[model samples]
Target: MIQSVRQTFNQAFSPEHYRAFLDKINADFPGQLDFRVAETPVFVPKVLTDKLLTACNDIVNVITRSDFKTLTEQAIPEGQRVPNEDDHTQFMAVDFAVCTDESGELTPQLIELQGFPSLYGFQPYLADQFRANYPIPENLSHLFSVANNAEYLERLRQMVVGDCNPEEVILLEIYPEQQKTRIDFTLTEKFLGVAAVCLTKIKKEGRALYYEKDGRTIRIRRIYNRLIFDDLQHYPDLKTDFYLTDDVDVEWIGHPNWFFRISKYTLPLLKSPYIPASYFLSDLTDYPADLENYVLKPLFSFAGSGVKLHITSTDLDAIPSEQRSGYLLQRKVTYEPVIQSPDGLVKSEIRMLFIWPKEDERPTLLTNLSRLSRGEMIGVNFNKNKDWVGGTVCFFEQ
Candidate 1:
């Protein structure tokens, strides 16, 4: 974080301007946003930006390990492993808390990493809206390895739709119309020509998958997968012809197996100065004496579900040894409230988004998204009736 940049942005920030920014977003894509947009974009200086990237690379080292798949073989639960997993994930998102170290210097600590797609379709647009609506510094840009938004969208087109006719590549979701992230799906369609197809609507004949659109049935050649099994499990009674575990004929972007392999399950496998001390609950013979400083997280849950901020030895002992493998004990990283808002400082969590083309050796760091929070954690439930706190992008100092 840059103090000077933050000060300048805060001094110039006005509620009226924020109102207009929201209005512009709504006008551009009416009712597409289901989540709150933070009033400001984070101004990250080179020091913290470099640290974030370094932390990402450190975690990626584990994901890219030669035997990563073999090591995480048990991560995929029974009846959950999808068929035809690719050599590597097409997308990865690594989250970090902007924290202070023992020396009181601002540093990044790994929070969670996922081998899944984030708001890739909408982040660039939001970043540009921040630029158009405010006086963002000339030296900062939200993009990486590209010159501008156009180039970024071009790269997205290549990764998501490839050379196939856009209609043949669908952004697959369980129910495209209802997800909170449907805005990104709409934007993806607008920019890349790929339509969002619901799993229920997909008609499967043998190994081939097809979805109806515009009075015609379209064959699916590639799938930009956005559905996760956790959501699908919610509707157990719903019948779908095309199941994720089915060995479909279509290629997958963001294969389902990687979601399990590179999730919280991989935390214990990572060893980095930037990463917090993490261990599988099953492997810990003795619980830490200071259990208050560690967070108990379920290996399979998402969106902060099944996480206990405070725990005791008794709590740890209560879990059956057989079920302990499904949980993780991670040293807590204190979030530093650094972003200077109008009334108070706000803590921020930045998720570094990356894309790995089929031919690439590693994921390429692109733009990033940051969540501002005045509550205990980063989510709508925690930050109720909060301002200057929600989903937003980061402008890294060049």
Candidate 2:
């Protein structure tokens, strides 16, 4: 964080401005935000930005393959496994811990990667609000190579919408307002001009899907999909038409397949200094004698639901042998909160956002989301009532 900007911003920061910020968000959208919005934005330094970009490239390389079709087919044994959970993971949130690499140099290493979505919509709006209310440095930016908010939106459109009219694309979610990440859906709708329609709201006829808007039925051409089928499994009673495997005519903004390809299961396959060494539960050559050093994670689960941190041999043994195949033993990389915390130093992980150009093979590092925590885990519940710890985007020096 730059001291000059911090000094200027702090001088201007007030309770009134904070109130206005919330009011502005409310005015911009008619309802509640899905995820928690922090009072301030995190300032990212140059070193961390470089490391994040490098980490992203390492991941993109593994996912972009000439023989991806064959590779994907081999990876999935059944029709259900085709998406590979982490495959068409449209939004890639690579969490990084600033750590010393093998050469003893400080570097950001991969802590985790999720197939889930983040605050793509709220970040730009929040960034603008931060600039309006605080004296952020001119050189620092929340927006990356794509210029300002409008350009960023266009880039996102290209990523998800392509040449299709924006009105035709819908940001699909399951009862979006009820989901924890509803704010993202709202933001995506606002910025991308895509409708945030739930699975229940979608109208189906033959093989087509449509949603009504302003007295008109807009044909669904593309889906900026945010629905998690895993959650769909929870509610077996509900009949929904937006099943990804249903052979719908619309193109997926974030292909469902990428979610399965680049996940905890694939982390073991990606070799990078920025990434922790991960082993398949089935393929682990030799289990660490000290199981305490690693965390056990199920291949497919969201928001740290199935992670067994502070792992023990007994904990690993308790898992049924049949179920063990679905998990991975990931070496724990200590995340040191180098960012100054108000009370004391707190650990932090930065989730780098990316957009893969349709023409370009690699996805470019765009903006970032940062999470601060005092507890061992980075979940919001773990850092409840904590200051400077919540859902926040980072403003990095360009």
Candidate 3:
């Protein structure tokens, strides 16, 4: 983290400015934000930025390798490949932690990587609002490239949907109104002119999926899928005519299989200074002596549902041998409370956004999302009742 910029922002910060910022946001989209917008932004320095990009390349090398399919098949489910798919994912996000190395220099460690979609619309829009209200320095930019928020989002849209009309592509989620990330869905619809259709709302006829918008039927050709099968299991009674596992004519903007394949399971295989030590439960020949220094995480669980922070032997023994294969033990990296708060320092985590264009050769870092926390963990529940700790983003040099 950049200490000078962090100190300057906090010293010059005003409650009135934040209130104006919120008012501007609500005026644009009323009732869109909850009480979480008042938190501080995560300031990422150049050193951590460079390290994160380097760590990403290390993982990308593995993903694009010749034996990558074989390596991925070690954990990925069989018979799930999209028969004859070629270059479908147009967006990718790799999250990293700003951690201190043995030499005490702040460096990035890879936490997780995904070839999936992110909050492309809201982040850039929010950045502009931040710049308007806050006293952001001339050198610091909310965007990664020379392109502004609109240009970047349009580029992403062109990469994902191509020449297809925006009306034909729908951002599909499972009961989006009930989702925690409904704000992102709404923002995406506003930017892309696509509706956020619930999975249950989709009607299947033959091999095509369609959804009704304003009582008019619209054929869904490209699906920007945000549904996770793990979450779908929660609502057993919910019915859907369109199924992901079924062979459908719809082209996926972010393929579903990659979510399961490149998630926490890949953490163990990735070697980087920015990534902490991770190991699959089944593959460990000997137990680590410092077991308390690690956290037990289910490879496929979303959010933090099945994570055990204070890990114990009894907890591991309780799981059946077959089920143990689905879990992993990740070394706990202390999130340094570097950002100065009114009371004390706050901890932060950076979510890096990337766009993999079909016409381009590699993934580009476009935008970012960050979270500031005062508690041990970075989630809302963990830092409840704490100040200056919630959803935020970084403004870096363009």
Candidate 4:
């Protein structure tokens, strides 16, 4: 963290301004934001930024290896693999827990990485609101791959809605309206011109997809997919015309297969000081002696689902041997409480978001989403009645 930036931001922060900020967001899109927006942004110093970039490149190197796909073949559940997955994922998000090294200096430890999209649409808008209302230094930029917001949006447009009319490309989700991050859907349409279309409403005819818009039906040319394929299990009772695995005439931006191939499943393949020790539960012959220092995680779950922070040999043994492959045994990184909140210091988790065009060889880190937590981990359940704890953006020193 930049001490001067933090000091000035803290000095300029006011409850009234924060309230006004919330009011402005609500007024712009009433009742769309179900998640809390943290009161302040994280000011990341260049040293830590450089380290984070190194950690990212190390993991990306593994992801970009020639035999990466062959190694992760079993990652995709047998019946869940989608049709016509691309050569690579168009979007990727890597999470890091801010921690202190042995030398007592700030360092980023890899928590998890996903070849999936994050809040690519809303992060820049969130940064703008913070700058407009707060005393943020001009040198600190939230974007890296591009110069400004307009260029960033253009990059997204080229990747997500390329060659086709905006109406022909949809942000596919299970129920776009019901998702908590609907604010992003609204913003995506505003900037990218792609509308959020629900899966249930898709009309499929002879392997072609179409969705009803304002007055007529529009053929789908591309899918900026946001739907988690596993979520379809929740609505098994409901009938749908289009399924993810169905052979459809469309381009998939964030191909569903990469979500699993590059997840906790790939963690064991990475070798880096920033990446904590990770092993598939099914692959472990002998449990570590210090099981207390590790956490158990489901290989494919999101938003902190089925993650056991504190674990033991007994806990590991309880999982059926046949089902162990679905889980991951990961060394836990001690989160250093570093963000100076109003009442006390809070731990921060940074999710570095990247976008890779179809033609690009590697994904480009564009922006970030930082979460402040005072609880055991970063999520909604961890901090219920907490302030300065929730979704936020990071201003990296240029």
Candidate 5:
């Protein structure tokens, strides 16, 4: 974080200004902002920015290896494997906790990585709103590898709506309207000309998928997948013509199989200075003496579900032996509360967003989303009743 920029922004900050900023954002898409928006954007200095980039590149090297698919063959759950996976994942979101090392210097520790799409459409829009409302520095920007907002959005459009009519490509989800991140779905439709179609509503005619749009049955040629198997488990009674595992004739912008392959399961396969020690729970014959330094995580859950921060030997024993392989034990990284706020400092997690076109050797880092948390973890429930703890974008020194 840059102290001069922080001081300048703090001097200009006010409750009224934040209220008006929220008003403008809400006005753009009324009643769609279901989550909190932080009062400020993070000002990341060049030093920390370089470290984050290095960590991302290290992880990318492992992912782009020739035998990556073979190495991650078991990552896909038996019944959940989707057909027609692309040559590579179109999207990659890598999360890092702003931490301090033994020398108390700023550093980034890998938290998690997902081969899935993040707030691709909403992040740039949020950054624009932040810039319009705040005095962001001229030398700093939220974009990486891209020049401006138009260029960033254009790259996103090309990846999601490539060579196909936008109408034939839908942002596929289950009960998308009811999802918490529905604001992103609205923005994707606005920016890319694709509609958010729920899985239950999709009609399966033989091997082809179709969805009705304004009294017309439109053929689905591609899907901007936003659905997760964890969320799908919540609706067991609902009947659907098309299932994710079905061999449908369509292209997946973000293939569902990569979601598992590049998730917590892949954390153990990765080796980086920024990456903490991670191991499969099943493979550990003897539990570590300092169990407090580790956290137990389910291999497939999203948004920090089934994560046990405080671990005990008894907790490890409680898991059935056969099910232990579906979990991971990772060393916990101490999140340094670096972002200065009016109330107090808050810990932040920076998620680097990347896009990999089929022709590219690896994914390209585009922009980032940073969350300020005043609680034990970074999420809505943990940061409830807290100020300056919500979703926001980061402005990196250019």
Candidate 6:
């Protein structure tokens, strides 16, 4: 973090200015902002930024290996495997917690990585709003590998829409309008021509998928998939003509199989200085002596679901022997309260977004989103009735 810039921004900050910033975001897309926006954007110094980039490269090396998929063949759960997976995942988000090393120097430690799409559409809009409402430095930028907002969106369009007509590509999700992150869906439709279509809404005739739009049947040639199989469990009774596991005749921009292959299940396989020690609960013959420093995580859950920060032998033994393979024991990284908030210091996590086009040798790191937390963990339930803790973007020193 840049102390000088943080001091300057905090000194200039006012309650009225923060309200106006929120007003502008709401006015841009009415009622689309379902989550709180942090009062300020993080100013990341070059030292931490360089370290974060290096950590990402280390993880990329493992993911891009020739036998990466073959090694992770068991990651996919039975009866949940999706057909027609792409050669690689189109999107990836690697998370890092701002931590202090034994030397008391600020550093980043790898928290988790996901081979799924993040807030790719709404992040640039949030960055522009931050700039419009505050005095962000000219040298600081939230974008990577791109010059401006237009360039960023253009690159995203190329990956999502590709050679196919924008209208032919659909952002597939399960009742996307009701989802909390619907604002990104709205922005995705506004920036790109693709609209979010519900799974039940899709009509299937043989291997072809179609959806009714404006009273006309439109063929779906490609899908920018936003649906997760875990979310589908809540709607077991809901009937649909097309199943995700069914071999369909459409191209998948972000394949569903990659989501399972590159999730918490892949954490133990990764080795990096930034990455903490991790092991599948089933494979651990002996528990570590310092069990308090480790956390138990369900391999398939998202958004911090089913994660126990405090661990004990009883907790580990309570898990059925047959079901232990579905869990992970990850050493918890100490999140230093580095970001200076008006009330007090807050812990932060930076999620680096990336895009890996089929032709590219590896994934390209693009803009990032940072979450400020004043509670036990970073999530809606933990940070309720809290200030300066929610969704926000990060502006790094160029």
- What RMSD, rounded to one decimal, does every model reach? 0.9, 3.1, 2.1, 0.9, 1.0, 0.9
TM-score of each: 0.98, 0.88, 0.93, 0.98, 0.98, 0.99
Q: Per model, state how many residue pairs clash.
A: 0, 19, 5, 0, 0, 0
lDDT tens per residue, model 3, 1-398: 56787777787787776777778888987766663764466667777677767887887766666665556665555544543244534677787766788788777766667766777777877777777776677677667764677688787778667788888998888878776677777788887777788888889899888999888998988888787777778888887897777778877777787776667877877777677899988887676889999899988777677788898877887888888888999998777767787778777778888776655666677888887877767778888887687777887643
lDDT of 5 by residue, 70-169 (tens): 9899999889999888888999999999998888878999999999999988999999998888889889999999899899989999989998999999
Model 5 misses residue 82 by how many Å? 0.6
Q: What does candidate 6 score on TM?
A: 0.99
| lDDT tens readout by residue for model 1, 234-275 | 898989888899998999999999898889999988888899
What lDDT is reached at residue 37 by model 1?
A: 91
Q: Which candidate do you rate higher for lDDT, 1 or 2? A: 1
What TM-score quantifies how close candidate 2 is to the native fold? Answer: 0.88
Q: Give the poorly placed runs of model 2, Cα more than 4 Å off.
A: 1-20, 67-91, 99-106, 115-117
In candidate 4, position 236 carries an lDDT of: 78
What's model 1's lDDT at 231? 94
10 residues in a row with least lDDT, candidate 2:
80-89
> CA lDDT of each candidate?
0.91, 0.71, 0.75, 0.90, 0.93, 0.92
Query: Which prediction has more favorable lDDT, 2 or 5?
Result: 5
Query: What TM-score quantifies how close candidate 5 is to the native fold?
Result: 0.98
Q: Write the per-residue lDDT of candidate 4 for residues 215-241, one digit (tens) a residue.
A: 898999999989886677788787899
lDDT of 5 at 101: 86
lDDT of 2 by residue, 114-209 (tens): 544567777787788778867777788887777788888877777777788889998887787787767677677767777788788788777788
